[model samples]
Target: MIYELNKSHFYKVSHLLTGDLVNIEIKGVVQGYQPGWVFVEHIDHPKTAMIWSKAIDGFYFIGDENNTDFNDYINQFISLDIAPRAKDLGLISFEFSGTSLSWDKTLESVFQNRELHRSKQFTYKYKNIINASIAEIELQNGFEMMEVNVFLLEKKLSNLDFVTSMILDWWDSLDDFFVSGVGFCILYKDQIVSCCISSCVTDDAMGSHTVTLNDYRNHGLAKKLIHQFLTYCRDHGFEPNWDCMEENLGSRLLAESCGYTKDSEYILYHFKLY
Candidate 1:
């Protein structure tokens, strides 16, 4: 039988998570620095584990994939306990800590009837930045760009809160976000049109979340914002992290343009709920 681990004991499985250090979401949740759930094969000493983050609708599995009992229990738990309630939470996406044919085979078997969708996710590491021409645009009229802070968020000016909330979905509160988070936004007529921010953060790295308004695309706004964000991270000694679906050509191109080199790739399995 599997057991749910108390948040206090979440650290028990940290060693198993070394394979995905760039996944700040995993670090955040596992450390209880963010919200999530954890389950293990053994309450006293776990050999297998599952962690789920509600904010991102993401699940991560780690350790002992060859454990038949744990595998059987998890398959049932996901199908009967989790799958039925997925709609309430959001569509669930599954990722594993390390590459294991055993785990991969188990995933296919467990989700065979659940319409599992698989895709590749690419992670990028910050290298030397490719400086872009943003000063001319920054000097342009009606374009204002600035760092995001408590004061700026507190002002509640012109859809800033909405965009911040939408992009920083992993953060529970603005207070929590500003504790270590950093972001930059470009505004047109006081309206935030393009922004890039630290979606997840740790002592040495910061994950990225970038968005541009639909009508504001193709104007180099995203590039400018990313360049500024990366510059800030570089100056402050934090490595900027980026992850995107392999199919997202635009996002991949943008990251490459900003000097983020592809570091690793992983698979994500999406399960839909009725």
Candidate 2:
């Protein structure tokens, strides 16, 4: 029997789900910040065949899902009408991770009538970089890497518009990096121009985000923030990592400059709610 997991199971499952950026929100799930849920074949039993976690309009699946029971769990949950409620959000995506081979069969066994399209996304991992990384080259004419307090999440929240909203929404994960001084921002006389934060980190790989005020584009601030973020990863145990939709050339180039290359890609299955 498949059981819906409670927050208590977070610590055990978080590490397993974190390799992907969306799954890293497992931090919010464990911290009780939002309505996140996980389903597993066995409740208290160790090492069950499959586990599924519900993300906003999408879901993330992890575990050794090569077995038939994994397919059974999908049918069992959908039979309970999980589909209609999930699809009510319009369109939803399912992202699968890890070395599981039976995904095509498993999906076929369940959604025989639904239309699903497969798309690929790449995530880069750092390889063969020196011990210390330089955070900035020459600050461009208009911008400078201003000194921002590491623990001042509130000041940023009250001052900026877009970045503030993101920080407020995902405070738990951002706070983990904020308190550690793992990010930086550019300033131009009191108005925050560009900023970067270590978005998420696992034992092995670290994820990042960069933003700049609209008027401040082409000022080389994004790279400066990224270089700083990568440097922190160098000193720490985590590998500098980046991931984006396959179409985002800007993100791809940014990662390339830091000596990172495309390491792994995942398939995203998109389904319409109609």
Candidate 3:
């Protein structure tokens, strides 16, 4: 029998299950945070089943427990009329200690390369790396200080705007990094100028992060915003993570400039949904 999970219970249990890898510190309608949801499985006994949460509906379980049965769970909780169709699901991990690292066969297949291996030297460098050129633009007359807002939720896809929707999509598609926080633009005269989203996760094992905007390109806003987020993460016990498609020159240059060493490589997979 599936028991309804409350906010307090889900928060407590998710931390216990993932060993604090998942955090529920933002405010939202649900018990956790945006784009991520947690559930406890009671197979045979409610206490014995593994606890699982998905950030951006991409990967279902992290830190080991049988994920083979996730489809069954999806079928059980999601109904055509009540839930969004299952788009994709998979697993990914990063090791920050070395240049060589080994990923699962599934990851290699997703990246479409067979030479990817798990070693200290291979793990810290990003495979299929991409670098992007930085554009410089002067701020308007009303630009001011930067700020960050972190929200916790108990459900998925809460009241998000158009830009937030794109950010969530990007987070779902990218496996080498994870969303660390969302940032809003500040104006010199106290008016809002732009907004950006940032992430924290490793490529192979090296820490990195990135920030992106909607229509505010060609400005140095992203660089400053990402730096603020990185500083926050570092101060809060998280190592920054950065990675991108091999062809994404803009992202690569940004990461490298921010002191992210291209240490290792890995693969990202998208499962076909029927």
Prediction RMSDs, each to the true structure: 3.3, 4.3, 11.0
Question: lDDT value for candidate 1?
Answer: 0.73
Q: Once superposed on the true structure, which residue ranges of model 1 sit more than 4 Å away at CA?
A: 20-22, 90-102, 110-113, 128-139
State the weakest 10-residue window (summed lDDT) of model 3. 94-103
lDDT for predicted candidate 2 compared with the true structure:
0.58
Q: Residue 8 in candidate 2 has what lDDT?
A: 70
lDDT of 3 by residue, 144-254 (tens): 544433331211322334334445543443222233344444333433334444532321122323333354566676666555555555445444455465667777787
Q: What is the C-alpha lDDT profile of model 2 across 53-106, one tens digit per residue?
A: 333344555654454455556655654545566666443544443333355455
Candidate 2's error at 146, in angstroms? 4.4
Clashing residue pairs in candidate 2 are none
Q: Rate the local accuracy (lDDT) of all candidates.
A: 0.73, 0.58, 0.38
TM-score of each: 0.85, 0.76, 0.46
Model 2, runs deviating above 4 Å: 11-36, 46-57, 76-101, 128-132, 146-158, 169-181
Cα lDDT tens digits, model 1, 1-274, are 7788898998898777655432767777876656788888888788878888766677877777677768777767876777756656556444443344456677777566776778888889886433322233353567778887866666646887656675458677776777777788887876888877778776667777888889888888887878787777877777788888899998899888777899888777776544
Kindly indicate the candidate among 1 and 2 with the higher TM-score.
Answer: 1
Relative to the true structure, candidate 2 has a C-alpha RMSD (angstroms) of: 4.3
Ranking according to TM-score, highest score first? 1, 2, 3
| Top-down lDDT ranking | 1, 2, 3
Alpha-carbon runs more than 4 Å astray in model 3: 1-35, 39-55, 63-142, 148-193, 197-216, 234-237, 262-265
Which run of 10 residues does model 1 get worst, by summed lDDT?
130-139
User: Model 3: how far is 196 from its true place, Å?
Assistant: 3.4
